[model samples]
Target: MPEGPSVRKFHRLVSPFVGQQVVKTGGSSKKLNPAGFQSLWLQDTQVHGKKLFLRFDPDEEIVSPGNNPLSEPLQKEWKEEAGHHQEVSEQSSRSPGGDDAVPSGGDGLRCLWGDTPAGGAERWLQVSFGLFGSIWGNEFSRAKKANKRGDWRDPVPRLVLHFGGGGFLAFYNCQMVWSSSSPVVRPTSDILSEKFHRGQALEALGREQPVCYTLLDQRYFSGLGNIIKNEALFRAGIHPLSPGSLLGLPRLKALVDHVVAFSAGWLRGKFQGRQQHTQIYQKEWCPAGHQVVKEALGPPGGFQRLTWWCPQCQPRLSLDEPEQVAPSSGARAPSTQSLALEGP
Candidate 1:
């Protein structure tokens, strides 16, 4: 699945065309069709986590369930709330509206577009991807060719996007559509811990540290799939099957840092600069020294995902030794010490 960084990259890749009009479109799942939106126009776009926020001008009309055209009433409510819901440009007069315009009911899959009253139909098309979905753009043809299986519904697409030649293919359900607007939490450390203990990804976490898989828990961070975890571990030289709690503080901390740094850079469309060519994801050879990094698979760590590591470059440590020593039988944890500063 495309993780946060990848989705961020998608945002950068399509930012140039945010205000461009959609000249053509289609979806195998007719349910996702953006019909009846004759006067659609592009507005603006943003990216948060693995999701893309596309703010449209009044030109794009959403075809709600039953083909109920979003009318004037909805538009008025949208303008009133647009300021709170979307990022509006100073040069632009129209607002993107808030929760009101985007109905919370229905099959939740219909698509459409419309035009603003005064603007020259400045269009907005948002292509979003969930945990496993993605934006193919012109690459859709290549994706279709490379993986010859399943219809549109075969994949759990949260939304289907059609915007000119370079469109998006969104994945993942939109259950928590409001997460982007929520207030930020402090410290923000241990995103992995936060996701494992409090969200949907817990079910996905397998085995212990080093051996544990990242995608198993979407909560650790959004958009991680087997591909990223496998490569990241291999690069870090940690064994994939190592217990989730065993990958010492230094290694685990480094891993978390890698994910954060990598995601930040990737989302900004800087993978080439962030990742060394040898560490380039999915490549067969270690670009650093041409060492053949073998693909490891099977019973350990969910086994299905493929992991590659250069034995010469990234060595595995003895499992008998734990990465780091826990504070003590009576000592407080470092995490607790940090949290204590908040109290009186």
Candidate 2:
């Protein structure tokens, strides 16, 4: 699972398509298909948690569910009707029409050109790369190879976003579709933002789940996944089984800061050729000469991913009490302070 930090990198990687016109769009994901696609400018792209959102500037008309929106007379008619109603709505209100854009949801791909007309979307694509899902194409062949995804041409893609510039974005073996625009709460902070500092981490740590589980929660950590979670715990010298409420303010804050800093450094190191290696994510031993142990740490869902930890580093402390471990000399654990802010 790509965590917040990884997703931020993905956002940067896909930015080349921005400002380009959507000459065409198609995908196998039921959420998105042959139904509605047109030429629209891909204005920007963003990631909220693990979800990737591609924003297209609003178009003059909305695509009905069962129609080929780009088709002849129907497209023209929809545009005319949309324009007329937009004019009337604008004249009737002094405020910006709240209906100018519709948000999105679900697992798949979406593409939009610009500011959506009434009852339309501002996104060109709302892609939720489920564990194995991804967006790739001939244009992004090099990127695909870098991600070890073979190549776009190898397995024939189910989704294709054709840009007016003659370039296209492709998706293979991914669930692509259009998400409904709805109002909902999104993750509070992306790991790259200043908003995801010590204060925010402290709030997330206060959850009742074990320390490891709290970090895994997307609602708080957004992009954090099993890999980062495992390595972060080992680095922080904190036990994964420790109850969140039992963690001391200083230790919890330090752990949060360490994870945040590590995430940023890991992302930066990937492109710089800095040894971008994993410490103990899949290793059988710790850097300190201890045999790494594997354990299932979540509630009985049978979905608990494998957790690797060093006994010498992270002790199995009592859940009733928070045990503070001395930060290992070889590890980097930046001390931090809580802002006394409320928890989410």
Which candidate gets the maximum TM-score versus the true structure?
2
Which numbered prediction scores highest in lDDT against the true structure? 2
lDDT by residue for model 2 (1-344), tens: 44554455455555566677777666544434432456556665655555566655445343222111112221122211100000001011110111112254563324432223344455445455544444543343222232244433333445677876667776544333344343232434444444444566678788777878777665566667787788778777777887778777877866766666666566555434454467778889888888888877665553467898887778766745455456554356543321111123
Backbone clashes, each candidate: 34, 24
On a 0 to 100 scale, what is the lDDT of residue 65 in model 1?
Answer: 22
Please write out the lDDT profile of model 1 over residues 1-344, one tens digit for every residue.
Answer: 34444554555455555555555444433333444232344455554333455544445454322211112121122211100011111121111111111322332423342212234332223344323344434433222222334433233333345565456533233322221121221212222122212222232233354443443344344444455565555545555556655555555554444444433333222324343222635666665655545455544434354566655544455657665433211111233322211111
Residue 226 CA displacement from its true place in model 2, Å: 1.1
**TM-score of each model, paired residue for residue:** 0.48, 0.69
In angstroms, give how far residue 170 of model 2 lies from its true place: 2.2
| Off by more than 4 A, model 2 | 25-27, 57-124, 137-153, 176-187, 273-275, 319-321, 334-344
